[model samples]
Target chain A: MTNLMRGTELARDIVLRASEKAAGYTERTGRKPCLATVIVGDDPASVTYVRMKQNRSHKAGLESRHVALPEETTTGELVAKIRELSDDPEVHGILLQHPVPRHIDERAAFEAIAPHKDVDGVTMHSFAGMSFGHSEFVSCTPGGIIRLLDAYDVEITGKHAVVIGRSPILGKPAAMLLLARDATVTICHSKTAGLPEIVRTADIVVAAVGKPKFVQGDWIKPGAVVVDAGYNEGNVGDVDFDAVTDALITPVPGGVGPTTIAVLLEQTVDAAWRELDA
Target chain B: MTNLMRGTELARDIVLRASEKAAGYTERTGRKPCLATVIVGDDPASVTYVRMKQNRSHKAGLESRHVALPEETTTGELVAKIRELSDDPEVHGILLQHPVPRHIDERAAFEAIAPHKDVDGVTMHSFAGMSFGHSEFVSCTPGGIIRLLDAYDVEITGKHAVVIGRSPILGKPAAMLLLARDATVTICHSKTAGLPEIVRTADIVVAAVGKPKFVQGDWIKPGAVVVDAGYNEGNVGDVDFDAVTDALITPVPGGVGPTTIAVLLEQTVDAAWRELDA
Candidate 1:
């Protein structure tokens, strides 16, 4: 029997708690917890994603305010809008949809959001804090992955964790969080040589490469807990799910993707509580 | 016959060039390269280290301004003095001697040094920049170690590099630097499990555990390049030099220690040059 690492069920549990907290916060503050989502350009996928997130926030008893920008928006213009939201005490969290126009400096836009309100945790301040094991908002995807691990009661401390892929959002931050937990962390990327040898020794494998089924079953050690954070086109993942016979694995569609939104909402409520307290 | 990595010799070359550049900058700018040395209290080791560094700087034709505070100095007082040096045009670089006092917040003092004058690069700004592959002055000892690696032409790209130890100044920063070079980087600390197995698979091993002969010979893969960055008591190193019969290794007493001073001088000259050019 293939043991599945179920993310959807765990996320449902987290979201239910977040919704309760958000409702309590609204009762105390006399205003709903608010998330400001700023999306630039007219990419269809980005629009759909923003709409979906907004819908989820509403369902969770939190409010999302949308700020739409034209495709020709300049970097300065985008940063200005983000700064306004960052300074607005009424807005508890800020979410800037990715894939801003190629002309704009995306990093600068991300950095404009204040650290306290960066619930999405895309800014360098949050990244640095998380890397150093300090108390700060973690990147949503990695945060969700860690939550899943904790929910499953995976013993991370003193384990050999191999993280494949090095993207700033997923692989790199995930490794940092794991290292902070006392795990011996190894980060592999496109330039990494002897990838299979490294993968074969891991107690935990986090496959985050965007390519479909890039990590084979032979690469996994016996009884290792595998977390596939990849969700590629056609609903495929970075790890070959069918290849691993007895190990615990997270499936593609219901795995990390579903849990990310859960983490995002949870952090939003946290940010709201902090802001209200402050 | 065993191949030994000559870290002292390489460091000497760097120091010579650095001294020459310092001299040139003094001639052009009519001021010597000056490093402000801030010492919180009079710990015997700290006193000796400060004097040794000042003596080296003077021999290299750089001026050393000493600010020795009393043991009762508060964090704010120390920060004020560091800020004075940070704003002083005469000070090209600043080095606050570490291990201030049990009562004082060391990180607060580190953050006081301005990035432009942070020749030692102990600030969070430097660490963040290094992690993101940006051009910033690196932590001195780790920066010097990287220079040693480059001088030896040890291939870093696509290599399985294992780093033991996780101090902010040494192991952690070194791991980030190696990761920046496209190496598959693994960080093992005191809490790491199965360290021997991990080290056995590395193409390149950096031992900075601060324990004498902690890593044995059989743990090294054949033909792997080993860097011993540890300086333990009695002039012994982290790696057991006598254990590895054929691998290239850096000798403890003469290796990474000398390179530390070299990097400090080089960065001081670099800061002076930036001032002169500006």
Candidate 2:
């Protein structure tokens, strides 16, 4: 029987832990943990993502502060706004909705978020910390994938994990995290040759290329665990759901999405605790 | 006819360019490019390494400032000394000799070096920059490996490059650089299973496990280029030199050593230029 990797169930457990911690933190400190969500322009997808995060924050007993900037905001203006949030003592975490205006320098804006409060783990400092295995804030998608794997008691050490995609926030960080767990990790992209043959050799496969059904079932090894991090149009995923007879796999709609929000809330609470101590 | 990748010749070209650049900088600024070499104790190998770096600096028309801390120096003291060098306007680059006293926090010491002046690329900032495909200073060994590959005109794009080992300064950084160049990179370590089978698939193989003759030549694909970055005891390398027929390979003593120092000198000069501009 192939086990469905139910991200919703796993995410519930994590959210429960974070919620309890946040309650106690609020009770003791007389203030709730705060996450500031910043968005530039009104990209429909970005707007929905921010709303989902804010809703989840409320469910987790955390405070959500929303900032909406105009479409004409320049990179300098966006960075200045992020810096203001970074300096705000009440804000414990910051999440900048990605794909800001085409003219805005997204990297510069992300870098403006202070490293300690980078709950989304989009900055260079966060990437460096993850690469060095120091356990600082990890990009939410990759962190969720790890939590899903650990919940299933999957043994990562000595396994061969092939990751398809190299986006800084998703694919690249996922490979590094797998490597840190002692898994032999191979990162492939659109430029990679012999893609199917490479996927067949993996003990674990992570499909994050953002192309719906890009990875066929036949490419996966029997009994291999697969995590599909791609959420494309119509709620489709990179891996063809019907193609592979896998020992474990995450479903497209519910698999990775909920877990991402769970990790964000958990890290937000963690940031709050760290800040309180400081 | 198999081609031997000669580091000395490539390094000579690089050093000559750096020397000319350094001479011009000195004439313009009335001061030479300076590299500060810091050692924690009198380990013979460490001492010899520092002296070699100093000798190379002079040969390249750069000045070397050596700081030998006592064996009993604490991590705090070491960090303080490095910070002093970081703040010194004359010191354009800083090199912290590795394997400090067992109790000393080497990571902390490396972090103490200012990011712009981290010529050796041992700090976390340099590693992230390499991973993100932004050209900052790279760790010397990986920088040298890239230079050697470039010198030989090895085609890396879309190639399968397997790197053995994951040491922070060498293996990890080397894999990141290869990935940045568009190669599908697999990182293997002691925990990796079926290592030989994995190696046989590589179009390019980098042996950096520090175990002498650990990677047999039979594991190498025919016509594949091999780079042995390991300089094991007794002038041996991780790859068994006599065991495989390959298109190109780097010898143990001269393959990667000279190019590493060359990159150090070159980066020191580059750092001086950046600092002067700032």
Candidate 3:
């Protein structure tokens, strides 16, 4: 009997709950829960992602505002635009789509969003708050992963969990959340030696590296829970699913990707709740 | 045949060099490197530490401006005092002695000091900057440990380094710095299972668990360079010195402790340089 952690279904459930909450808030206060999407350049992948996010937000009964910039946009220009959105009361959640043009400093652009409206949790301030276990906006993918693990009744405390990647949004924040859960967390990246050997020791392995099938099936310990956060080319993931039959693993395309937008919408409703109280 | 890393001697050398640089800067710019020490109470240890730092600053030809507050001072009052120091042009480094009265929120106190003047590196901003591999004021002890390692020509890149502890000041930042150096870093805290077995795989071990002699010598891999960043009661460290014969370990009292002050002084001078340039 295979116990699959279905992300698309879970995401649908989450989006519906968020929509209900958002509708309740709108009824109480005449304003829809608003999310601002800041996109730079005409990158196809970025455009697709932002459009998907906006579609999801609209379906969740949240207002979606789009700010598109040209490819030649400067970091200062992007930062100014984000700051304007941050100051606007209508924008409850701000999503600065990643991989801004190479010339524009991405970190600087992300920092432009005010901490309160940083619903995507891409800012350093949000990162620090999350690491300190404070109640703040969390990185979307990691936050969604944590929700998935919780929904599955995965016992994280005292578990030997290993996170295979160190990206600011996904891997690092995931490790911090796991650490806060009383799990013994270890982060492995490009510099890591003996990758397969370390994977065999994990009670929970989070394969977040973008490389396809980096973690082999034989490397997974028996009964170990696996979270493949990678969305690589051709629907491949960081972990090789064919090799592992004894463990519970999230599917590549339908697992982490669907939850990203769900978490974003959930956070939008949360932001609205906080703003109403304020 | 002592191959041990002596932190005290190294720290003294660093302090001496900082003193010379401080003197030179004063001669060139007609102003001494000044560190403003803000203390909220007369906690004996705090007072002692402040006095020790002042003495060292004086010896290093740097000026120390002490801002002493009453024991009953509120968080707002303490923050205002810290802000005053932070804004003072005469002060290059702002050091808020920790463990401010029980009534005061110490984190707020740390936040009051601007990141540029945060030589002690206690603020979340400074922590994030250092963790992300930015050139910022690092936590004194961890900064000292890295300096000690580099001075000894210990190659960190592509090496297996295990850090024991998860404290903001040491363990987490140390792991980040090691990762920046291209070393595979693992942070094992109290919840870590079979820590000894994990440590055995490390080529470099940083014991910062705070418990005296918590890491056994048998757990240390042979010829691994050990940095004992812990200082507990009776001048004891996290590692059992008697248990390890093959590993090069840093002793308790003479190890990470002395280097803390050295790093503090160096960072003060660095802040002075930056402020003058600005």
TM-score of each: 0.93, 0.99, 0.96
lDDT of 1 by residue, B1-278 (tens): 45888878988898899899988988887889998899988998789878988988998989999999999999999998899999999999999888789888887888899988988878866776677777878888889788888988989999989999987678888988999999999999989988998899898899988899999999999899899998777889999999987777888878887888888888988998987787
lDDT for B19 in candidate 3 is 90
lDDT, candidate 2, residue A63?
98
Across A174-263, the per-residue lDDT of candidate 3 in tens digits comes to: 988888787877788897878888889899999999999989988998899999998877889888887888887899888878988899
Score candidate 2 by lDDT: 0.93
Query: If both were scored by DockQ, which would come out higher, candidate 1 or candidate 2?
Result: 2
Model 1 interface DockQ: 0.71
Which parts of model 1 have CA positions greater than 4 angstroms off?
B272-278
List model 2's recovered fraction of native interface contacts, to 2 decimals: 0.87
In candidate 3 the C-alpha lDDT for residue A235 amounts to: 87
Docking class of 3: medium
Better of 2 and 3 by TM-score: 2
Instruction: Label model 2 with its docking quality class.
Output: high
Of 2 and 3, the candidate ranking higher by lDDT: 2
Ranking by DockQ: 2, 1, 3
List DockQ, one per candidate, in order.
0.71, 0.89, 0.67
Q: What tens digits encode model 1's per-residue C-alpha lDDT throughout A176-246?
A: 89999999999999998888988998999999899999999899888999999998778899999899876
